[model samples]
Target: MNKEHKIATSMYRKIAIDIAQSVADGKYVEGQKLFGRSVLASQYKVSPETIRKAVYILKDMGILDTEKGSGVEVISVSKAREFVNRYHEIESIHSAQSDIAHWAQKQTQEIADVIQKIQFIVDTAERFKNSSPLTPFEITITKESTVIGKSADELRFWHNTGGTIIAIKRNNDLIVSPGPYATFREGDIFYVIGNDQTYAAIKKLLFE
Candidate 1:
């Protein structure tokens, strides 16, 4: 809300991204201890307060366990994943809570059932996060080839070629599924899922 809050939020967002990336890349894992506050500060070139801000954000997001004397340690990647899934659930609730509640009141039903599904997804994601399964990669797209949202034709082409678009990264936002027929703009990174040949073809299309 205020300037300081805004700054902290921004820093925490970066930290969250970093932590998620680390876990995804297997740099960190469940039960692994994290570096202390001062250590992180020195590594990231941030102030101790900034590091604290980041750490606290991760703590609230359910990624790290912190003790006064012992310092911070990894709890579970599943917990971190759950944190993200729960955040999405909160967003959905914020959008539909009042409307859903009113509808439920009129219908003499409960919204808890729907909310439970959201919770289940969050829980499942958390569980999987902790397990740290190996993810398969298919292709590499650089900052070139004019990355833009794929047209329906392009999507069809990729699909026909046996390539799957799992996710896309546009700055800090992650775009999943039914990509809205969006055209890829520059600076977009897509995570494709498919076999080796599919990946090679896609890479050739993009890079060569």
Candidate 2:
């Protein structure tokens, strides 16, 4: 949180708690009149506004009674103890909320960092693929392909597409150098290599 907010909140809350504790301890008994706002501010080394806020908290909790021109008076020792207990409970909840917010922010940052790293890796791989002539391109066999269920030898694969199949990925298995007799199956990922026009020829021969 902001430093100014911390000072404003903590100072007045501390003063209020101190006054309530005094009342609870019998240092200030019930029905006893305490100093005015300015005098209490001077005594506590705070501004009159701070004293007013502190007194307001006590009065709101029924621990103190305040009047405009008169003064502050202790109303109930039991209520003073209740106010202190309630303040501590609220402080505990605030501390837990702070901890949860801190961790959530940290996790969000870590997830962003991971996404950035993955994007960098993907961009680097794409650059390498585009720069290398030997890197094989991939195409998936679909139901529309005329070559589906046909063996490479029967379709005269290399003669038709002017490309060489390096591997066929079927399901979880990689069939490296699937020779002329290897039949094309739906969902097969063909890893092939050729000149620039080879991919277009393969697509035309298979789909058109």
Candidate 3:
């Protein structure tokens, strides 16, 4: 149940959607020739005819174009992948047909203006999630640093500044999750994780 039978009939279309998604994600750049039918079929565990059928769907969507002897090349891809994911959520045959039709219609519309808007939204969301610039950044312990030649406890880095040294790169090796007993050498670069304000305080404690 659960549309597996319909999946059998529409397997080629699903395969085409996957190929289109790869194009949209920049995995397969535009004008890049795809593998031959047999190779693609082997990769997807399908028959060569199935691959051919999928290529036809992509060609119809304008995501791919096939020349006489040359293989298919990607043309353009927008947020077309949403339709691929949406198709799996459809319950009825009518809904599935309607979804595919809508996807085809949108393929012909203008989407160059929307990609930048979508990218801006994505960037703004990331910025909102990561509001601090400190972000577990790294700093090398120079010879002029006050904290050099001092143990973590002797320096009382956490006492003066709330930053926690998560790791230290000494020589060519890495000391991970070091405790307070871990000594700081002149050349050891410490990777610390703390709030934005705490890292600023740590820098002041180290150099000044």
Cα lDDT of all candidates, in order? 0.65, 0.84, 0.75
lDDT of 1 by residue, 1-208 (tens): 8998887767766766577557645688888888888888888777888888777777876778898899888877876776666666886887798888788796553345445544654454455446744233533345576434456356464665565555555665555553537555667666554555666666656655
Instruction: Compose the digit string of candidate 3's lDDT tens values, residues 39-145.
Output: 99999998888889888877886778899788788776653455454555664677879999998777645253345444543464356449854356678989999
The regions of model 3 sitting more than 4 angstroms off are 1-8, 79-208
Candidate 1: residue 193 lDDT (0-100):
49
Looking at model 2, the pairs that clash are none
- TM for candidate 1 is 0.37
Best by lDDT: 2
The global Cα lDDT (0 to 1) of model 1 is 0.65
Model 3 TM-score (2 dp): 0.38
Please identify model 2 stretches exceeding 4 Å from their true place.
1-14, 25-27, 31-33, 66-71, 133-208
| Clashes by residue pair, model 1 | 78-126, 78-129, 78-130, 148-183, 148-184, 148-185, 149-183, 149-184
Per-residue lDDT of 116-163 in model 2, one digit per residue for the tens? Answer: 654654464456468865345788999888878889899887998887
